[model samples]
Target: MVQFRKDNILDRLVIVNDSSSEVEGEGNRDDHNVGTCIYCPGNEHLTKPAVLVLVQKEGIVRRLSDTEDNRIDDWCVRVVPSSNPLVSISANGTYSNKPFYSEPAYGYHYLLVASREHCRPSYIPAEQWSNVLVALQDRVKWLYMQKGVSYVAVYMDYDASSGWHPNLNIVTFPYMPPLIEQEVESINRYINEAGLCPICNIVSMEDKSPRHLVSIENFTALCPWAPTYPYEFWIVPKRHGIQLLRMTQKEIDELATMLRVMLGGLYTALGDVRFSMIVHASSEKSRKQLHWHIEVHPRLVDKHGLEDGFGVHFLSVSPEYAASKLSVASRRELAKLVGIT
Candidate 1:
């Protein structure tokens, strides 16, 4: 007899048919089938009803509470369930009581389309940028209250090309990922030894070091001292906050600008380099000492077998050098766009 089993490691993971090239190149933007742009305005019915949407009217960004009948002109930002979700919404199994080998992958996954029209997040119209950030924060707060969801991860994928449209995704996990747990543990140890937050200390040090790239009123973007990959940069809030949902409107606006500037800089420095951006925050329990930040990883180099097998990474670009190059590029591009001297 065959038995049904629930496993996290080997089951419930998302599978993508990557028939095309893995490394995204400038010319590869046209590789995606144009007819299958399901996220486009006219293709609203192709996916699930939007959970959250933000619209602009009279120069004010507002949320569309009613999503019964979504239209193309109804919203500027849309958040709907993913067409290909890695985890299911159904609570199939409870927390495992056993020492643990198998358990159901119970979670929530969502797709956040920043603009109704196909466009990159970095180059979105200045008016709608804040609305996009607001949509993400609203959805994150709602997902946390969901059953079996202990952690939430929000990320965006950008291709430095014209044909492809970037999208942001939010996924909730039943348990904290091992990487996050390890980071928390390290933070705890550092706090015990130094009587302060390591991230805050790093921020202060970077502010005074060459690794600093851009420093805004509320946020700062810097190149980490020891990045796992080349040109890996992080945009962190100066305020000591953990839950991203707790940020005020002004703070959110600042973050949106910072993201736009940093990403726009990358676009200027490296013509059409695809990159991944992720948001990290502490859970309710760990909110006291943890800080929330956004990490941007540019796909400059591929990881070799040794890096994967031994859990080590060899970066070709140093953090200081990368920071200098990115800084100049970001400043030049932003000044031209915003008319800043």
Candidate 2:
């Protein structure tokens, strides 16, 4: 979740853990599809191999996509790593363990399959919702087991946030800035204190704690703090030394459940918005030290604005009123309009 250091006018490319509540408004963004919403879950064959497992009380098993699944269904929230991935999780955790070192970035990326139903998270029942969390836990465990993976992170673009699609994200990566020693020295003398990567602080919160339990539902819209936009929120798992690719069955089930309410709330608020989700983790499979979290971004605009001089945000409304206007009934009506369950 790194923003542009300069901040002249950051493009959409550097959106690591950023979310927006009101759209900025654009020139010809008519390409948005407000008609229907489709997901991946019941459509097992349509997605990649099960990166994580989600089992219902009825014993239904589902996996998230690996950024490879083209078609999805209503019963699932398929995930896909970037076709042009930037980070690497194949290396071990260089950020956490001082003694352990491997390739710059040797980690893995896994997709999160939200549910077996097409409806929004609000529509999902409580158990199934918990299943989503359990699946996430299972995947987090699996990622840690890898020899090269160092970290695993989950993400989602909830409702109008990224188009209101209920899904999960996972990311595993290695921290290797070329001027490593110089960077440390520079920070120590001028910035503020000794070796301090602010993220390192959060990482330390659960760096060694296994029973790390972070609530993803609360926060400034289920996304990371300082969300680019107003309604960004997050759900990072507290397990310090685990990845998100390999999780226990129980964990996977419970994680899925958490996603249900998180997403469902978005649906309950927004009216069938569109969104996306994915996982960010260490590359190359090197096991390292890093915490995991799930993020949610709702794309909604209540009032129009001028952040779009050329053609970036072009939102139709303001965030204050938009957040107030969006509600459960409206969301349900929109969900039905889009053919969501």
Q: Pick the candidate with the highest lDDT.
A: 1
- How well is each residue in 1-341 modelled by candidate 2, as lDDT tens digits? 22211123431222222222233322111133344332333434533444444333356656543334433343333344432233433223323222321223444555554544444556666565555666656666776576644445555544433433345555554432222323334434542554443434554453323212223222112233234344444545445334455555555544554555445555655556655444433433433223334544555444244555543344333443334343333334434433342
Report, for every candidate in turn, its global Cα lDDT versus the true structure.
0.71, 0.42
User: Positional deviation of 53 in candidate 2, in angstroms?
Assistant: 3.6
Top candidate on TM-score is: 1
TM-score of candidate 1 relative to the true fold? 0.85
Clash pairs, model 1 backbone: none
Q: lDDT score, residue 40, model 1?
A: 68
Clashes of each: 0, 129
For every candidate in turn, the CA RMSD to the true structure comes to 4.9, 12.1
Give the backbone clash total of model 1.
0
